[model samples]
Target chain A: MPDKSLRMRRAGGDGLVTRPVMLAIAGDSAAGKTTMTRGLVEALGPDRCVSLCTDDYHRYDREERKELPFTALHPDCNHLDIMEQHLQLLATGNPVLKPVYDHATGELVRPELVEPAEFVIVEGLFPLWSKLSRACFDVTVFLDPPEEIRRGWKVARDTSKRGYTQEKVLAELERREEESAAYIRPQRQNADLVVRFAPIEGRDDPAGTSLSASLMMRPTIDHPDLTDVLQSGLSRAMHLKLERDPDGRPVETLHVHGYVPREESLGVEKAIWSALGAPDTETPECLGRLGDARSEPLAIAQLLLLYHLTDAAR
Target chain B: MPDKSLRMRRAGGDGLVTRPVMLAIAGDSAAGKTTMTRGLVEALGPDRCVSLCTDDYHRYDREERKELPFTALHPDCNHLDIMEQHLQLLATGNPVLKPVYDHATGELVRPELVEPAEFVIVEGLFPLWSKLSRACFDVTVFLDPPEEIRRGWKVARDTSKRGYTQEKVLAELERREEESAAYIRPQRQNADLVVRFAPIEGRDDPAGTSLSASLMMRPTIDHPDLTDVLQSGLSRAMHLKLERDPDGRPVETLHVHGYVPREESLGVEKAIWSALGAPDTETPECLGRLGDARSEPLAIAQLLLLYHLTDAAR
Candidate 1:
């Protein structure tokens, strides 16, 4: 909420964070992480944020992997220790030569230089699996959509975008389910926040195809003022749906309908702010944050969390 | 032979023996293939002889080979198809980017350009083993030295030239022996000539260690005149040590002892050449077929034989 360095200076001691703030976006293949990430990144602009993918850590290319006993999804199939070391280097405000994975030929080609920025988002399925690498991240979010939605998304995305046929995508999804459960799904329970973007079932308005999203923020961590998040008006047509998280844990859900009116979404955003103790200043103290115009509320929420993560470390 | 080319030209035919020749030099590791190749090349000059090594075909470095099931000596551990293709290309007067094997580090550092010349000396352990490749060589020689001599040479070369310890050198030699036996030694039996250089086993010469050499020539097919070989003073010192080959094939063996005097070695070379018929030009009606020093006996025997082999098919 304040100049982090100045905040510490005013607090009368030099105790401050030194490492750059990092976030890990862990999700299954075709689980809406990239779509959500692209939208949020576009809204935030590029100067203050940078992104890296975990696929570059794979030791062998697709063709090479066919000869190996383990599939690419297994941790041993990647140079995880090397990846971990690179993440630590980036967290300390440096850079690394990231290996290139050519999706067209499914080969590992030349490496490219990846420079670190103030906010780093490392996105991949196994990003949170290695504890040593996880130590570099300040904010960790896991995307968990229902299996039916995930499968549908995977089929559509793989067929349309990855040069796969519908049958092949579906068959691959079925085959991967066991490994997905064994390795990927368990990571959701450990995230600082869990995000899900899907239509709330059983809701059939005359308008049809209602969609909703919820950000489950854990307590005992620094919370952000929602004044900036409300500016993008993402929750305007949505409802701040809350209920006991099945395991007796506290959880809040935002449920939006596809055909909901725009003004209603704005109203939902306002409710979210009122719920988070939106900053009381007349104009708002968040700049460089959520910005003035071009963005969405969900994006602003993501940035606000990143600010807290890096600022708290300082 | 008379000028058959002149008679053929008059009869509307060609008798210049316009075929590519194959020359193979097989030897154990560090047994002087590279050294002898350097000497032959210098003497013949670049225009007449081109030397290439099979070491360039290795698929992995030494460190990587330790993890592999087979040793580098195995054909599967090399890009043999590419090598055979390159060899065929070179035999047809084409150039190839022959890969370089850094013997010191046991790595393929880079590919070197090797253009076809008049004589192509293919030197390596398994050069003669490939049936398809043998059709390309015109002459083949195997370098044979005693086991103790080879070990001493390897120890000295690996320590001083390759930067290896005597212990490591010995261990590597032992590790490669099985693969060598299964892959390299059989090629020796296919050689046209076996040249062995070693000290006389029991003789003690007071002056110096005058090691003898034996050049076992099986020129059952067309070969350059031995008269030229005798004229050069190598024939007299070569005692005809006849023996049946291991396969029970009858053959003539020419032996030169370590204790032989220099003058006698020269005398022996002359006696063999005189016996072969180089001085047959003494008649009044017969002008010598070779009128220039360029066609000298030693040059014709060594370099021309190389030329015949490499140009046999082409």
Candidate 2:
């Protein structure tokens, strides 16, 4: 009945009401959004975290999209207004009857009720597409894999999991390129962190080497102190360097090497975990799970996000 | 983005934007809630008005309720919080993805998008159950037909249309009596108008005579000026008198006679319709329809509600 802010105030027992911390993971299709979200949610545990995808707000089913002139990347192809409204409700610690879009059937299915937990993680292509939606997030992230790498990942995923031919997935990717440039990529400017996972630009990696992660942390919110971790003799695993963003602004970027030994990356993870001051002494094993294997770089990236979520809850 | 009040202010074209006028028709099952809503929505036309039943907010399907201790009339049996939120949205001219309850199969089905027009008519069991819900309505009406008459109507309708046995309907009504008293009837105190349709007390009418309507207009809203219409030499069709309410408070009541000739009641209808100051000169033909039959009292009652809706929109 009352506005959310007032409701939050009234819910305080010691006159210190705290709303849920909201995180946004925005990226193009097959850009590892689900992988990033899965690790964070697993680390936080299901009781403390809830996740949803904005693709549920698609305006048309897969069959209906075949008749439209535009792909799903365009804002006009989705119910962005309703998505914004639902985001506001979730951010305010309210439950929403969230729409469900079934990827397997390519159909719009029955809606399910989603109650927000202490940490709300929203991942999809359009989480940061608008100002109102962007305002709903406390920490926003944009996944920025290289175009060639992302395309390869998409083809492999579509063929293996989604029952699509490599040619069809590639053609769909080609068709979505214009709208991705016009709508999706521009959202990178609004994110608090831009994360890119790829092989080093000028270096050749072994066939089985995992991809490294480059994280650009903007000064929009107070970030965790990583000065001690950088000097902990883990330079082969991670290092901080000054870089220029696309907007020609100077930013501090953290690079975590995937070629480093797992034990070396574990040292870096421990340093960041101690900086978090989390109640748990050991890092959660659920972090960095990619199917049956694990990636140390993903574990560290997720740990940094966990640090922010815990910091804001404070 | 913004709260409804702020959104309304920013929506102004001439700096006087008005939100949609909301009307709540609350009553027990088979108390003619749908009949009353049908007349009003038909009179206003589909382009300018939209109507939804709060029964759609039921938390359980009909099959599930058989196992629950309470009937659908209980507040706990419905998603009242979400219903309150949706009412707030519709009252502010915002669209909602409303849940659907299929009465035929007694199932909770897919949700449908509802965009409010100039007027929103909300009808069903618990629309007026809570103070917060009552506050969303510009005009509220509670239908209070006599118990015997309502039971008869329920039996006839359920048997003929819903494929229910008259014996089963009677048994169900008996089972629901306690909850109807505990949760439904008390909402009458919050309505702006309490309407009862039955034969006049201590009088015998012809075998086929229609039921008359007695409207108790509360002082919560400024009702239209009916002084001239009451004195327009139509006493046989309609008249106003002072009476004490169930709470022993003095109130003005309008009594419309169903036994009056059709031409005489039409004169009263014309008087009320003209008093609305509407641009249309002729009365709408769709009002007061009971399937293939019609009632003049139902027409006059609907016209009075239309007056309130138009007045609030101003």
Candidate 3:
């Protein structure tokens, strides 16, 4: 393609447009994609930000997928074309009559209308799967938590919330591994940022400590200058280092430690917020919320995303 | 407002597109819109053509409309934006997740996917109601039957098929008259072909005779050359005359007589089909069907629409 921003401006038809900035958070099931998206949406508030799950585009309900040979992770098992079309419409500041797949009932329910706002956060398995859909996003991030940790998250969430038994969740995870490898993992290479949240390897942390976050910031877009903030005596909470990406390319990676003191994390958060030149006096309190608990690593990661979204709007 | 054909070609990327031709048959309720659209879809075959009713975009079901202040004919009472968006998608040879309205139960049911074929026929109210929507059609037609004939057809159809009593139908018709004039009838000004089916005024024809058709073909698009065909001694069945259109503009009107003998109508049909340059030796037998009865005028009107559709495809 053509430059999507230019196409979007032309599609506006001479009207004044603060065209919505689109963000895609793509990952496999229970990879913390929703967790990453929810904080950003909450911080921006519902009026300015709207989020949707691409899982709603599933061609087969949970029961229907059982009859099919392939899992829902495969592109063929979902209406990816319609998802791409809806993304294009949303990116161009249009409304969509979106399909809704009810995970609880394993059935396709009545669709609802989704109106795009200033920030459209789309998270699911296939938002970044296609070039057309990927083109619609101003920034794309992929969640890549380790398989072991992701399996644990899936089992806990499914059993506690979705009413699935641990055995059934484990079996479904086992069945989905092949498709996840073939389809989901490959999308990480296309992301502007690859985020992995996990406990530090080889460092035994006390129980109840949140997982640290490692964000691999690719050179696809101009990232915020964190050198000054990192140099301002905030190294205990977060630091940046040059690392090799999965594709063997060198990238700047920011690692936020979850075991850091709350005051130190607050100092780093204030530094990043001020660097963003945001008009608000303080950072949004809604960031990094995991139910009732707050995760410092998630808060910093969401702050980084907020910087990119606001920068693109400019 | 930009060139839609060019946009559609660009949207197709490198893929070769025999882009589906679009035809719009817009009219008030019981004004023969479905009858006109059905014949064209049948003649083209399901594999080559698909049809959808815009009334499916109704924002309220029959039961819900009773609680509203205005009738369903109002633009606010329908998702015209979504309808327009779907039309744009279809015109570009894309599939739409279309909403379905259950007219019998007066309920909004689950939506279905609609894939465009070689020909896409869109009928019902509001297809020609907006400039953006009207732009998506290759050929636009408005059914303009006389008020008396339309009311009679609505009463007959609603009572026999839709389970509406004659008194209820008449009361609803009376209530809808203002909106029909305000929202529905005004679309006639936008259609390329204004078609009216009724008995010729001041002529005493048998009660069982088919209603004659008066087709006012505007100069908006290139019409088929019928000079040679009309001059070939087929005047007994149909004749072309210069007439002033509703807006007081000169237009070429073709009047097909319903009382014409079957042999005379067949001769006219064959001539028109040959004029269309179709390779088939005979016209489709599905044309002009009216519940086990055939109408010669209906067949000729449908043939005229077929000409426009195929011409646009070329």
Candidate 4:
């Protein structure tokens, strides 16, 4: 409990060779992190990867906290130290007993045992907030979207599945904004990639029909091998380029078109796998490279990084 | 919490006519209380009946308690007084913010606001253990399925739903016997009715596919006017008889056969409704009787008794 951030950093830096890969999917409420994570988990299978949400560590059961001054989204309202410990444990391949929170009811549910896998994706707001929690991850992604887009997504999801009335959804969103700004927004600066999907820029972008994205990749890490990935799968409209953010850090940006051929994505995967020098074995497909939009490419790129780090461990 | 039982008895003896009625279904672990209660709830409709699990108030999350001497089922391992407060709140029209428990992972999940309904059913091991809780119940039931039947039900349920191995279930069952006896079994004497379902007395009477049920009813609560019910349609095999335990307390027993047709149940319902003399309007079909092989007559008897108790209070 002595400042979890300090412990996480200490645990992370001590005897670290090629640091074990850590990734975070930071997003506002329901911006598709769960959907994307589901696909990733399906592709990688749960054995090689485990995903956890930072919301589990809320400090109070919903009712008791209602009397508190601050809402649950605030830092003081969570067991940040305990969450950091579990993250560290997971990153180190040890099992951690994590707390449970019921989203629909706004209460702390039960604790669940989470065994570590090769990759752990920590998803939620403020996941990248504390230096300790951030120290535990080697790669972090932030999801950003326009207000109206996020709100629309929230409305449809909550009403149909969660029994929420329109008024409750809007009220909750309004109440959470202050905490989101103070605690969740700052975490984006620490992320390796920031993915944003919104109506396309600079045109007659129909309300919700178009999509565009921006990715911010930290320069400290080695880039993925993307030679064959670039040659196939991606339509001519899909391309990658480098740009410097306002902070002056270089970013690798991938632009994906609204409509891309499926085979091209498959071909891109094959190319990236071949670049990994593993000789295009079917074993990787079974290992879970089957669904990445650029699954083959991302699989090879991700696996190459993993192989390098694990090999360096020995 | 000024002794919840004291509060309830005050509501009764002091002539508080407006308070919502509270009913409890008490039993040992794996008893048929959940199934029976589910039937009642579904039949009554969730709006009319609100049910809370005292089991949800465990003091420790599942993993932490694994190393502790007391299991989750032990009284000392839960926050009982808090549970009493919630029950008292629920017994009124007020809402109780109750704790959430995750059944799959055996952890405390979150809390939810449980609004009081017309009839509240508190179902769990210690529902009737404390005198404070006993005072709140307008009617109490103890489901005492034979040990063998309970064990069979438990093993099947735990293995299928809880991720427990057969050996683990058996071992846990063995471990719980002492605590169950000490903390749970004594509640039977305090209950208004004890419903037992087991293999009917004859092993060779193969067509005796019905489970025998004994309703140990305490007949002193002045019975309701069942004239309307008796006149409406209660003559179908639904007959009442008086029974006595070895200890000599008068017990009103009602027996319904497994093969009793549905129409006969409607008749029993109409008679009970007529007896209440509350309203002459049609009683909805959904309000039909909850049968436990022989509970039709016993329920009619129980309702008549409840009606008179309310009238006496007024």
Candidate 5:
């Protein structure tokens, strides 16, 4: 009801909700922020779901950032105030002149105008790091993949795409680890859903098995009913359990096995499609793709975020 | 490769295998067999998936069956040998003239011709009752919902659909309990997967919460990797544990909690879909519905069977 009330305040006076519902997906670099948002944008349709990166708020370009004492992960290295202002504008369904940060060139390009669509997904390191930034979105998510895995992903991505050597990437990761611990990780506490994709702790699965995923579902928002999909008694690839978070709060944790066959993951996908009111006639084909490869965990996580984005609009 | 060999044997020597993969869904009356199979048919497409009820093998009409000393569940009351032969015929992609027992009119109608499609799902009390029948399927599933829930579902269905009063249904249930225990229940042991749908043992969820389900993944056949789903930290609605069955064999039991939101179930479903090779463009819309009411457990059970049916074809 309160959520509806908030929606009312943000709507146009003509009794139609022209305001775009906002979602914030925040995480550290190489923490799967972009990968997560990519599927969401595809699933929701790029025309309807406007996506942006909060890293664009960087006051200093990559070259300039090197002179700073703090790493990019630190609050001092970024323009939190400007990011928050842009979020507020987007939340009210207003357009903003958003800056761009090119990862490949490490350059801050000229600002470009962006109009709010039916839904807006903002992904970056500090989207939920401040109260003002957090309040601008109806739903928030944080990626918390294991540090080692993140490091590996970061190294591989940077060396291949960003023109960095593996050694440079690893060293940069080590340098940024401290700031990440202080600034990026804490944002997870504010998220409605904390997603972690990692390998299972004990199993020595034969080669070609994908990593498993664990999501901490905090009661910050109403989620889709997953009991049916998990309990369908037909799949062994997924499960859910009520557990306690680090803050001692009771939360539900959903674990999705990646090594399972693709059909098992599709079961959960259909459940989501129905929960999302069967948004399209079919599940978005663009989902589950990471570069040329496919990742089911990423797709499911994006679908959950998509559910919230659309559910809030309704 | 061996499975392919069997396929070759079934084909008409063209080297292009055409044998339909078989799946057996065996359960007692009102065990959610039809409800479960309905989704598979829809998900796989009616053109590709053929479904048959082995109960149609009843030697006598329902009215005449009432006069017999043995219940319909008893081996003597049905043409189980004929059913076994038919199963073998279907398994090898052959056609069969199958008997039809019309539940609506309580009569033995004319036999119908059945040609196996890409997939065949056989549901009834005795489909897996005999070893010969069990060997006819590439995969087998047993529905073992709680007696109380089954009784409630049966009463609701028989009174509303069949020409039976609640009292008569109850009496019939009591009369058939012995036969169900002796003849129907034992068939569960022969199944590769045992699905039990029921409420959580302790909690009293308010109305509208669906029933939970527990699936016993027996090691009779290799299952897709589900560890990724069980280990994914996102959901609390589902869980997996290695436990001992009544026969003392170690099995993996997956429990899906019904109280979690639909989102949690979607996570698990996507994991399964990924495991199943992301069959189709979407999750089957026909799954999880039972007489206008949707049951997540039923949908999931159906999805799992669909996985087997499709997986065998691959």
Candidate 6:
């Protein structure tokens, strides 16, 4: 099949030009990608931002994957060609008939029509795997929580939402660890921002103390200036440090403190909201929700991505 | 009276030398100096940090100052010489019998013993006015809130706490403004950091949007690197902007946004907390309280000063 990007090319003299800012949030399963995407959609308003999960393009049902030698992290397990094509369509502000994989039932569902909005966020495992797919995005992010934290999240999610036993979830995670390492984790190198939310180091926090965040700001794109924010010294909960990434590249890491008072955290949020020039006077309530618990770092990461989207609009 | 610092100098002592990190928070009445100092004391722990209000050095009671030609902002209206001696003593880890000025009754009460801790935070109207006084501090901050905001705060504080009418408070502010401009405001020029907490520029927030803050990070002192915090793009609510101060000096200003989600502000606070090495998991609970409401910018300013205090210790 001809790549859909070719079909999406605007013909000369046609004068039908439409372009929406496209952002790709790529990560492994239960990496909080969808939750992060939801906050952006809410912050930008549903009417202006549209989101799609590329996991919907799974080649087989969940039970079918059991018979295969490889897990869903493998490219062969997903329809990367179609996902790339749809991403191309969305990038140019076009519509597509998209397939859906229902997570609860682990079954393929009927296709549905999807219209692109002013901002399009494509989030899933393989959105950044191919050069053609990567080209469709104006900005890209990779969620890279520690493996242990990710495992806890996945086990909880799979057990509660997908009806899998804790043992089954752990077994599956062990089974897919190699594929995830080979494929999904590599996407972090291509991301403009790599976000990791985890427990703060060297502190014995109370039971409800929020988890801290470490954001690796790669120099792949123009980022907002935060010297004023850091220098404002408004709250001790957040800070920035320079460090070397695993690939020996110089990267700036921003760590957000958790377990501070609620109002203090909001102070940082409003500053970010103002920076984005977003119309809202408050942060989206949909952010940071993991079941009943909330994550400050997750909300902040989403807000930064929202900044990129709204900034692109300007 | 024998100068405590002169006695502390020890012309020919063999050893027994120790020094305490001193921080000066100088500002006019109701500029939130005591509130700011409280947070730092809490963050560093009371055992390690001792705070004193320089207003305690008043040469005359409030009624006596009322009959005098000059207001409290005048150098002569305070025991500047004694304050200098005390500061010098505190700077080198010595104790002093500091006089107490009772704000409620407008009386010069009995003196109280003050022991020097690892960190000494001296806050009031004239802590940074003199060469000798300025030399006693390792770090200095000037709170320069807008006159309008200061007026409102003063009026509210005087009427409720000190038994003064709103009209009387306003008249007092006007009477003190000239002395404040000459004595208190000029101290801002010498400060390593100048903090201004007020409403965000050009935003009509609701009745309860926490006030925004601007901190001028002067290069006079070595400041923590905040490049990563700004680049992280986590909270658009906080940002660092380069701008010129009133004296035409180039300064980096950090602005913390208010009214954002609590989590967002915490993200910024956590980053700073992490930068400070996260010895304690929770932020100082006493921070961000401006009267009943909390100011994130105030907390951040305190935290930054805390960084300088601890950094000096190292």
Best by lDDT: 3
Model 6 chain B, poorest ten-residue lDDT window? Answer: B1-10
Ranking by lDDT: 3, 2, 5, 6, 4, 1
Q: Which tens-of-lDDT digit does each residue in A1-314 have in candidate 1? A: 12322432343222233445678888898776776565445544588677878877777887788788566677777777556656755665655556566655677654555677766788887778766566667778888888898899888877876777899888777777877888888888777777766665665353443335566666535554443544555544444445776556776544445555545544444444344444341212232122243223344345445444445445
Q: Which regions of candidate 4 are displaced past 4 Å?
A: A1-21, A203-210, A227-234, A279-314, B1-314
lDDT of 6 by residue, B1-314 (tens): 01211221232211244678889999989998877887788878889988999988787788788789998888988777667656765665656556678889988754555788888889999888876677777889999889888888888788999999988888888888899888888999999999988887775274777778888999988887776877787777788888999999999988876665567667666667677676478766777776687767677777778778878787
User: What TM-score did chain B of candidate 3 earn?
Assistant: 0.92
Q: By lDDT, is 4 or 5 better?
A: 5
The TM-score of candidate 3 is: 0.91
Which candidate wins on DockQ? 3
Q: Which stretches of candidate 1 lie over 4 Å from their true place?
A: A1-18, A204-207, A225-248, A256-260, A267-314, B1-314
**TM-score for chain B of all predictions:** 0.75, 0.91, 0.92, 0.76, 0.91, 0.91
Select the stronger candidate by lDDT from 3 and 4.
3
Supply the TM-score for candidate 2.
0.90
Q: State in Å the error of residue A309, model 5.
A: 81
lDDT (Cα) of model 5:
0.78
Question: Which regions of candidate 2 deviate over 4 angstroms?
Answer: A1-18, A159-167, A278-280, B1-18, B159-168, B231-233, B277-280
Q: What is the DockQ of each candidate?
A: 0.01, 0.29, 0.35, 0.07, 0.00, 0.00
Off by over 4 Å in 5: A1-314, B1-17, B203-207
What Cα-based lDDT does every candidate model obtain? Answer: 0.60, 0.82, 0.84, 0.61, 0.78, 0.77
Specify the CAPRI tier of model 4: incorrect
Mind giving the per-residue lDDT tens digits that candidate 3 earns over B1-314?
A: 12222332355422443457889999999999888888998898899999999989988889889988788889889999899889877876779999888878777766788999999999999999876677678899999999998999999999998888999999999888899999999999999999999887655275877888898999988887777767787666677888898689889998887887778777777777776677477888888898789888888889889878878777
Model 5, A1-314: lDDT tens digits are 13322332343211222677888888889888888888888787778988999877776778888888988888877767557656655665556556667788888653455788988889998988776667677889998888988888998899989999999998898899888988889998999999998876664264677778887889888999999878879677778889999889999987877776688888887898799776456777888788898888777777777777778877
User: Candidate 6, A94: how far from true, in Å?
Assistant: 83
Q: After best superposition, candidate 4 residue A99: deviation in angstroms?
A: 0.8
Which 10-residue span in candidate 1 chain A carries the lowest summed lDDT? A281-290
Give one digit per residue, the lDDT tens place, for model 4 in A1-314. 12322332343322332223457788888775665455555555678677888887777877888799787778888877556645654554545556778877766655555666766667886677766566566667777777788888888888877778999889878998898788876776787666666544653245533454444456655545564467554556445667876677777765544333445544544554455466546324432232343332233233433443333233
